[model samples]
Target: MRQQERLGLILDRLAKHGTVSVLDLTTELSASPASIRRDLKALEDQQLLKRTHGGAVAAEVIYELPMRYRTGRHQEEKNRIAQAAARLVTDSVHSVGLGGGTTTTELARALGSVGRSLKVVTNALNIAGDLSVRSAIDLVVTGGSVRPESYELVGPIADRALAGIHLDLVFLGVDGIDATGGISTHDEVEAQTDHCLMQTATRVVVLADSSKVGNRAFTRIAPIEEVAMLITDSAAGAPDLERLRAAGVEVITV
Candidate 1:
């Protein structure tokens, strides 16, 4: 196949499966890993894909932009971040708290495929739906008021549930993350719920795309130091990254 046609096929696979392992790509493409790596590198250079430790993912899935805006942006970045964050989980982690948002939803989806013995606590109805049918995983949907726009279960009920539970890790997604504001959300109730979620969890990981850096939304959830890690795409600029590091947050860039 022509190089252009081959690269197109790789991207199509990435779009279809959220993520692709290099070994799988090697088999499917019927090409040398070296050749596939070169193809991936070329596509990454064009911003059409983002390379992970094992494979390339479509780049349009990482944005915090509204659903319509996210429709065609950063797929590879989100997959990369989701995969990176997934590696942090082990079978020993019996319980996890998942925040509301597309990225967190992606994390939930990734986890569903990998771990069979996990108890997931989440306020996102869609996230609950994604894992509900998976008999291998235990799902806990926090009872709360629903925010239809974001599909999040927020407000007092959500906050109370978080207060009563403890988790190994809280996978948090945000509308904006800024040096000044720390972690933030656009809705006050969601912000309050997020704060409670963070407080109950042993560790907090702030999952966001590069575009979210330096942007402050309407409410602050927690300070930067409270976040154990910030998993973001490579598009996050050096200065923003420096700030995150200086604040003592481990920044993982994929």
Candidate 2:
């Protein structure tokens, strides 16, 4: 594999398992230990992982989501899904809960355009800022420690804040979803926070594009049934859609 791809795989493994030993990367990538060490060193230099005694551990702090990167991938599809998701929010949606991810970020923007006179609750600092200035919307940012990568507040403080609030709807974004693993992500802390968000909200809606479907990620956040609605682009294939439908998930395509 190319060095970049190999490093991505190493990061994925570390994110999933918490650590990646030299021998582990060597075996997984079919590379020499020296090559894997070099790759690890490069990743360490980028601050994506920390070098341990025998392997590398993922960095505790995630980098903030860059607008350039977020805007490029699945831009059109995310727009479609965002439009469809916006239609679900009516005058009855008094309270809103937002999660972290590129999709949910877009959903926040969509909500800003259509949702007026609403109480918005979110752990995402960016989303809070996005809706904060709007006169028609009352924004409530969940209290917690900030995770720099996603600009999200997570941990006990956020969890406690979530426990106290009851939302009419919660919008979630995910890294991957599979029948076996349900919904999953790259970070364990975010997964735990997402689980709490699911529980605290009256109705949970997951906003993901077609790419996330049927893909098993490192950390399982919530089961399929926990989501009352799965909103995605029209490209979600037949088999995955069928699987989601069979599992009693309300699937909505934009």
Candidate 3:
């Protein structure tokens, strides 16, 4: 596997098991022990994990992986979800809001390719960068402090920027979504900013891969009822889908 792919897998395993042994990673990643050690060291330098004698452990306060590392995970599923979401941005939808995440980033690219005139508002540095160059997109980027891990801008400044603006639809990328805990993310500040974006839109659609479905993250963005629809991969469990639908969210498995 490529280094980026290896690094992503290592962190994913650490997140699930809380610790990973060099032997296990070497076997699972099909890489040399030295290569695995190097990967561990690289993550340690980023403070993403703590290097152990023969392995690594999760950081004291585990935050979401940076966007670059997360891009390769569930990539195919994200692309499918993005395409399905793009269909919702019909000509009648003049203005749209996009939240930060890998899946939403893909949606931005899909929108650009559709060659439709749109007033796009976003708080993601990466998404803004991508859409800014598209002539058909009148891009509006909110002002706020940047969160490196997710490439999202959050805090009071962003909230103020969203205050009076209105959107026909908004696509939010969340860290987790569940029937009870509702929609959530890893950072409380980002969750608050995301909530502010939702308030500006008449319709709210959440984009999440199956892994995020049925899970609850650190901060709640809003209750499930606040969402109009959820687009996820078919890998999501049937029971979870039923629960989400029962909570008044139209769940779509792409």
Candidate 2 displacement at residue 48 in angstroms: 6.9
Candidate 1 ranges beyond 4 A from true positions: 1-71
Q: List the residue pairs that clash in candidate 3.
A: none
lDDT of 2 by residue, 110-204 (tens): 88877478888899998988998777888888889888767889999888888867889999988787765799977789889989888878899
lDDT (Cα atoms) of all candidates against the true structure? 0.82, 0.82, 0.95
Best by TM-score: 3
Cα RMSD to the true fold for all candidates: 10.9, 7.7, 1.6
Evaluation by lDDT, superior candidate among 1 and 2 = 2
* Backbone clashes (count) for model 1: 11
Candidates ranked by lDDT: 3, 2, 1
Top candidate (lDDT): 3
In the range 27-81, model 3's lDDT, one tens digit per residue, is 9989999999999999999999999999999999876788888978999999999
Number of the candidate with higher TM-score, 2 or 3: 3
Prediction 1 TM-score vs. true: 0.73
lDDT of 1 by residue, 122-141 (tens): 88998999999888788888
Instruction: Report the lDDT of model 2 for residue 59.
Output: 88
Deviation in Å, model 2, residue 173 alpha carbon: 0.4
The deviation in Å at residue 157 for candidate 3 is 1.0
